[model samples]
Target: MAMMQKTEILIIGAGVIGICAAYYLTEKGYKVTVVDKGEVCSGCSYGNVGVAVPSICGTLASPGIISKSLKWLLDPESPFYIKPRFNRDLIGWLWEFQRACNEPQMRRGLSILHEFNTASVELFKDLAAQEKMDFGFVQKGLLVVFKSLPGFKEGVQEAELRQKIGIEAEIIRGSELRSFAPHLRSGLAGGIYYRRDAHLDPYKFVRRLAEKTRKKGAQILTSTEVIGFEIFGKAIKTVETTRGDFTADEVVLAAGAWSSEMSRYLGLKLPIQAAKGYSITYRLPENYLEMPVSLSETKVFITPLADTLRLGGTLELAGMDLSINKRRVNAILKTVPEYIDINIENLKLIEIWRGLRPCTPDGLPFLGRCRAINNFIVAAGHAMEGISLGPVTGQLVAQVIGNEKPSVDLSLMSIERFN
Candidate 1:
């Protein structure tokens, strides 16, 4: 018979969400074990643009998304592209996404998402301060630079919606904007500046976080695959893995893109879909950069690390496959030179990677315990905003374990919303 070693809790996936949950749970004295099919901090959590952007509460599918999506469908090299494939799941997910973009749906999404993201940023600050992790985090603020008056007006509307939810942002145009990032090309018009927003070197951020989590008495398991679940009535009794079988009093399904397949064992089919994203990093000039920024019009993000510069952003609705589309990668790289004078010729491509963002139909993550099961909580499907929501997601998991009220209300993000 296999030795059934019992743990207080078992968390699947070693991504930021999982690690954050482990950090908080262990702090509260829970005997927790986190299992991943692969290495810790080596998944989608690694490849994000690394923004602490609370103001991006407005989802990708917004007021004009239907028309914009139609336009995007026709263009191959657009910022957000949906590659045509005969996969039923992928096609079905797209339809659900379209359905989730209506006015009432988007309004609900913004309300829930903004609250979650704002809480997350605060949690991040507290943990980073206590942990003393140097991840090149800058609270200097974020600027959404635009190249035309129409785009600037659109930026203002976004800022306005963000303001309605208490996100501190302002519309800046002309000389005020030019003075901020003087290197911007002469063809620029204006932008929106979210004063509360922040950025970090994403790769270094995740690497340091994982290392810090491990040093703080949490186990870091790499190259381990969670094969199946050991369900005992309403509770998960064990987490079956390729390496070994271990019992768990509770489990959190923070498995990112793999949550749908993994959740099936529990008789729950999470409508989570994998939205693939790409990013590339290049060398920063020795004596350069006024401030790290994201080009709003181009949808390209640049984060200034301690020494290197990370540029990332590009969403493709392709299924779960690790194959890199060099064409798509090139499509992202083409935008950098349009906004500012950066030496792309001299800088070598330090890294190029893809991550699958676990997306839900309504663009809100499924958080807290489900009505269908007990002791099997879920906290995945943040899509492009996982990094922005990691800390709070973890805190919420810990609160649920402690049987306390979560700092933020998650009723709107309940898994039953889909059902």
Candidate 2:
């Protein structure tokens, strides 16, 4: 090892969550060091839809999700899929997922997510207002367009649920749907417009925040993969990495999809599964959308960033696999033209990105400190909401490490919840 580097706090993972944690820790005057296996924002945070939607307060394991998943399994281009696997963790995760697929659990998860996302959006506004920071943050709201009557009905019910939770959801029907977004196709049943939602370039946000953290004297070690850990008693004394070894007073496991695998080295079993999602970015079309829109039935999201447009969707429970499925990508592209009046195939291509989002069984993230390890904390498993919840999660992690009470109640997001 190269002389055993030392710091007050060591955060593994340079994605949005980890970078935000470093940012807040540095602001708190803590000597923080962040190490990642790849470059900053090189994972799930890079190619996500980048929408912070508080109106989407539903859990992934909703009442009808199992049936829906089963139906989607038959279609190769379905929005959701679970590869048949004999893994013990996958089996256990499904069992927990099944248990959580109830109204009570879904409502409880939604309440927490609503709080997290709402608070994070405010934090995002604060970050955006900072001088020398511009990540294309825009609060133009989002629209969920439905093509089928059945899907529109379900969307109305979801909007009602969101209203009950204090979220503003406006239903635009008939000609109003096209009036809301003139570029949309005419056959749309309706759309639910969420005025509180916002979108940004996720990669820009993370990298910009990382730059600000560096300027604040925080150390960020890229291309440094964690190999193992030296646990003494109940605390991690040293983190062994590919480059060398390092010791810190506190360690955060924010390795996104890889957090579960990393936790095993510390003798903790985090019930987090890697959900693979794909995104296709293209050069901004002449008739670009003013706001992000979701295809309700197809589960695809179309977001227009600064100079490019991104179409992203699908949830594949393929266990850390990063391979891109051409059929699934094609399905997303094909579904876009059904709602929007745009020729996707002719658009200039930017990139096709695939990332593994860390997802927990109950559709909740694993936050807060670990029970077994005194100095270890977890901040992973945000799944699709990683960008939405990044800032708040980082602030909460800083609060926990600083021995201050967390702003939001983290009991529901306990790292040992599955246990």
Candidate 3:
């Protein structure tokens, strides 16, 4: 083993959260070190739709989500599919998720997520302006188009609920929706426009953020897998990796889907499971969308980034498996032409990306410090909002380490909530 090197702060997982933590800590003059098992943005951070949705900051474990999942269970191409497996964690996660599907929990989650995403969007704009980074950060808003009347009514109700909570949500019904956005196909019923939402190229944002952090004097070690840890009574003394041993005054676990396993090293239980999702990117044709849109019934997200278009959706709970499900990808592809006019035959594929989103059962991320470890802080389990909420999570992680009061309350994000 190489001689044990020390850092002021060491962060595991060089995804968006970990890299963002490094950025903030480095800006604060802390000697930070970031380690990742793969290249930067190689996980869930890369293939996401790159949407910054503040209006629809609702929890995944909503009241009707379980029933909806049941309907989708038989359909392999459904937007949400959970494999009928016999795993202890999956069963436990589903049970806990079901328990949290009440009005009270969903309301609490909406309030918390609203605050996080709102702050995150402002931070993203500020960072882009100050850093002069052009990641196609556009604030043109998001449109959720529904084809069925029942779906449109439900969507309108949801939009009204969001409106009541101070979000700018407007309904465009019937022919008004078609006239408002002529690019949409003829069969669309209506749509909800969220003016507060924004988007960017997630790949560029994460990679550039990593580059900026490295330039700010943070040490980034890629392909360095963390195998074990040396723990004292209430702190992590050393982080043992495949490369070498390293000690840090403070440590952060932001390994996303792998966080559950990483917590075991410190005798902590983090209830996070890998919720796999897929995205297919293609070179945009003429008259492509200027902004991002969501297919309400199909639950597929279509985003335009520069000259390319990306379509992504589906939540497949199949443990830590990284395999791509062709059915799910086809589901996304097939759902696009139903809403938008596209030439399916002439479409050229850029890449098919599949990633594991670290999801907590209650549809809330596990942030803040662990009760078992003094120097360790967790910043994982943001689920679908991992890309959207990256900046604020990083800012809060730094505040936690600096012994400063956090910008947002951490009670709801505690890792010990399961206990």
Candidate 4:
């Protein structure tokens, strides 16, 4: 028999989402306990680019993405790939994703994401300003550079869409682009600058925030994996974990990539697919970049932290696998020289990381209370926007649990929307 503990609120997963949720919930005077399968920030939160950009509007399910993905399917080193599999969930997710690959759905998702990101950016600014909370937060904005004319054209169109949605985007070309990003290679098409974007060291941010949450009377139990849930009449009665059993008044599932599997314990089907992403970190070279840069054509993002520079991108739907694919990693590495004038041959390699990003069919997160389970709330499926929108997602989760109106309208992010 497992020993049982009680808490006012229980949060699963100690990544950015769960830790942020714990931060806000503790702030709201809720007795919170957060548990994770591993140490805090040990998952995707540890190695992401850590960019918080409001200018990112287009989602993975945007129009023409199907065609682009079809083309990428032939190449093993493409930026996006869905591993060949005969799984029913993948098929169902693909079907829904196909339906969402249209103009209207994309626009709707873009609007929601922009709103979430904008609010989260403000929260990040606040968090960075707090005493003893330093995570290398920099608001120098982001530059999306294009090496090809076609890619630049599409980038401009994206800028136009962002402009129409009230996000500030400036399109620069030739000498102007070169001057804006002096480190770029010559003969590049141009770049678009999003002034509202910012970045930080993701690992430092998550770890520091976890420490702060712990100091705020929240119990953070790492190395505790949730194995099963005892549901009693629409409420989770006991959350059985490797450590023991925990009974809370409310439960939150912010387990990132594992949320789908965990939800099955509750007899709920969450249409979240774990999309694997890779990142390589290296020692910061001399005269390093001040702001993050996105290689528009290659889909890679370069972020310079305090002492390290990171190159990260690529989305592979390979289902929870953390194995690094050299071809895909090389695909990201080989594109750096083509876009930037940097010579990475001499740069000291640090670490190569792979993480599974939880993705929904429509590219938006599932972030609300379940209709059938009153005490159950989900804050997962953030896809690539988890870092960008983590704080806002946490605040909203707390609001929902407190029976307060969510700051952002979560109608589209319904937990049971796919049902």
For each of the candidates, give the backbone clash count. Answer: 3, 0, 0, 0
Candidate 1 least-lDDT 10 residues: 283-292
Ranking 1 against 2 by TM-score, winner: 2
Please report how far candidate 3 places residue 129 from its true position, in Å.
Answer: 1.4
lDDT of 1 by residue, 1-419 (tens): 57776777888999889988988888888877788888777889986778887776557766687787788777677777777778766766677778877888787788777787788778777767988877777787777888778887888887887787788887777667667777676667787777777776665666677677666667757677888776777777777788788777778889998998888877887888888888887767766663557787767887776666778777777777878888778877788788777767788667888899998877888888877678788999988888888888888999987889888887877876766
Least accurate 10 contiguous residues by lDDT in model 2 = 52-61
Candidate 3 lDDT trough over 10 residues, lowest sum: 174-183
Better TM-score candidate (1, 4): 4
Local accuracy by lDDT, each model: 0.79, 0.92, 0.91, 0.92
> Please, what are the lDDT tens digits per residue for candidate 4 over residues 1-419?
85689999999999999999999999999999999999999998889998987886457998889999999999998999999989999999999999999999988988889998999989988888874689998999999999889989998998898899899988999668777878999899999899989998989989999999899899999999999999898788999999999999999999999999999999999999999999999999989889999998889999999999999999999988899999999999999999899988899999999999999999999999998988999999989989998999999999999999888899998988888
After TM-score superposition, what is the CA distance of residue 384 in candidate 3 from its true location, in Å? 0.8
Q: Candidate 3 versus the native: TM-score?
A: 0.99
Instruction: Give candidate 1's error at residue 293 in angstroms.
Output: 2.1
lDDT of 3 by residue, 151-259 (tens): 9999998888777779998899868887777878987889999989999999999999899889989999999999999998888999999999999999999999999
Per-prediction RMSD in angstroms? Answer: 1.8, 0.9, 0.9, 0.9
The segments of candidate 4 whose C-alpha lies over 4 angstroms from its true place after superposition are none
What lDDT tens digits, residue by residue, belong to model 2 across residues 1-419? 37999999999999999999999999999999999999998989989989997877557899988898899999999999999989999999999999999998998888889999999999999998864689988999999999998989998998898899899999999578877799999978999999999999999999999999999999999999999999999899999999899999999989999999999988789989998989999999986777999998999999999989999999999998899899998989989989999987789999999999898999999989887899999999998899999999999999999889899998888888888
Q: After superposition, which runs of candidate 1 have C-alpha atoms over 4 Å from their true positions?
A: none
